[model samples]
Target: MKDLFCLIMAGGSGTRFWPWSRTVKPKQFFKIFNDESLIQSTISRFSTFISTENIYIVSNKSQSAVLEGQTSMLYRENLIYEPVGKNTLPCIGLAAMFAELENPEGIMVVSPSDHHIHNEKLFSETIHAAIIIALENEGIVTIGITPNSPATGYGYIQTAEDITGRNSIKQFKIKQFVENPTKSQQPVTLKREDFIGTAVYLFLKYRYFLNQ
Candidate 1:
């Protein structure tokens, strides 16, 4: 698994978080729970499974200085600087290029730098499983988080019948990626077990990762 690579998406300024999370310091850098900021926690959590050198953080040029200062202990070369924010698709593409340059057959894991995973062990196991599935088969793998609440703020993922798994990481033919619904179109009630795409994707093959 030396070719295994982790792409940490840390570009967003997280305007939704408001006053506390500003442009200078986004939600990912916010210390919501522990002394460690969200981005720091993300790097620390994954470092236990993957080497610091294998982890690459994709962030905007403005946030590069802050990210560098915060993640100085980690491999500095792995920090990928994006001149602009082009959303996940383009960011993933850039990371794929970097991974391919390092190792043509590299397997890349893309994840957000702001999420809070309560179960680190489970998350790691799930990610590993997804990596295996993605490598064995030519398909995109995404980690779907079981929604804890009826979040109108998040988009929902409807899994295909063939995809089956106890954990959130399951094979799904992405039915439809729904955006956050507005108040007028909001449903009366929402379920807790509803699945939502965490934007955490796994690319098993470098070619497949780059093409997608």
Candidate 2:
């Protein structure tokens, strides 16, 4: 088995969920739906597949202390504190660098800490399959979540003809990257807008090599 490394992006302030999600405590730290916070839930879901030591939480410096107290399984060093938030690209780049340093052949899974997965088993199985595809193909692989609805709040990935299989890492030509709709309209209704980019990605071994 390849050495698996998980990077949980927990840097967002979650302005949409504001009032409750202040700068001091972002949405990831809030247990809005269940017993555990979003970050905790994300990490717990991956624990079944990867060891605690191999998991990493990349976030801004402000939330480091709070995050440290919340989860005992995560160590201080494992929590990477970035000076400032430069969005997903930079975050992924830093993670790739760390993954390369830790293990050149490591399979790194990068995902947001705030999102929830209804089907835990299926999600895990899919992620594992993606890692395999990434290692074999030696290219950047992103997992496009099976769209439950036409969600306007999230970006859509128009899959290319080459894509196949339920858990396969298929090539998806980056189509229109749409923003959250202004209001709940017709087909763009809140519920119908289900196909949102989960920001979940699997960086292949060679991709990791190049980034580092």
Candidate 3:
């Protein structure tokens, strides 16, 4: 069987949860809602589909000691130390580059280190579906969450068409990526189908670990 790799981006400064969330220790390594930390939960989430051996963490030099102390399951070799923070695009690109070099045909699962999923069962099922979709098609498959509100905090995706079917969820041809709008700019009557939220689960065809 081909390998499934998990790349965790944990280098964020975590400004949202400031004071508690430090530069040396981001929100990903802390647990406010659960006993296990956010990053720990993320690892557990992906570990169901792939082994810890295939799991990799990409963080900056600032958090090396904190990450080492907190993440016991993560191997020293698996911790990719990025010197500088360039943002998610560069971080993901670097992970993908390393993965492709390791195993071009492998399934690469890229996700943020910090996130709270209320629906664990549904999340797992959706990931499994994404892996299957990527494997069969041998391409990139991005997972977008079903929007529950019209809050302008998150960027929205305008769907060209709704390709939903019985039992299965709908797939859309992304018409445009809309930036966050102000409170007054928001739709007065909000509906579930108004927009698609970002869960940040990116499944790309590739494969492993390289500390930068």
TM-score of each: 0.86, 0.80, 0.85
Q: Residue pairs in steric clash, candidate 1?
A: none
Indicate which candidate wins on lDDT.
1
Q: Candidate 1, which segments miss by more than 4 Å at Cα? A: 165-171, 184-201
> Considering TM-score, which of the candidate structures 1 and 3 is the better prediction for this target?
1
Query: Whole-model Cα lDDT per candidate?
Result: 0.76, 0.71, 0.74
TM-score sort, best first:
1, 3, 2
Where in model 3 is the C-alpha error above 4 Å? 149-152, 164-167, 188-194, 207-212
| Candidates sorted by lDDT, best first | 1, 3, 2
Residue 69 in model 3: lDDT: 82
Please state every model's RMSD to the true fold in angstroms. Answer: 2.8, 3.8, 3.8
User: lDDT, candidate 3, residue 58?
Assistant: 91
Model 3, 71-167: lDDT tens digits are 8887778888887899766787777676666667677888889988888887887777777776766456667765656677666666667654333
Cα displacement (Å) at residue 135, model 3 = 2.1
Task: For candidate 3, list the clashing residue pairs, or say none.
Answer: 99-207
Residue 25, candidate 3: alpha-carbon lDDT: 85
Candidate 1 lDDT, 147-208, residue by residue in tens: 54556666666665666655565556666556775555335324323445454555567678
Consecutive 10-residue window with the lowest summed lDDT within model 1: 185-194
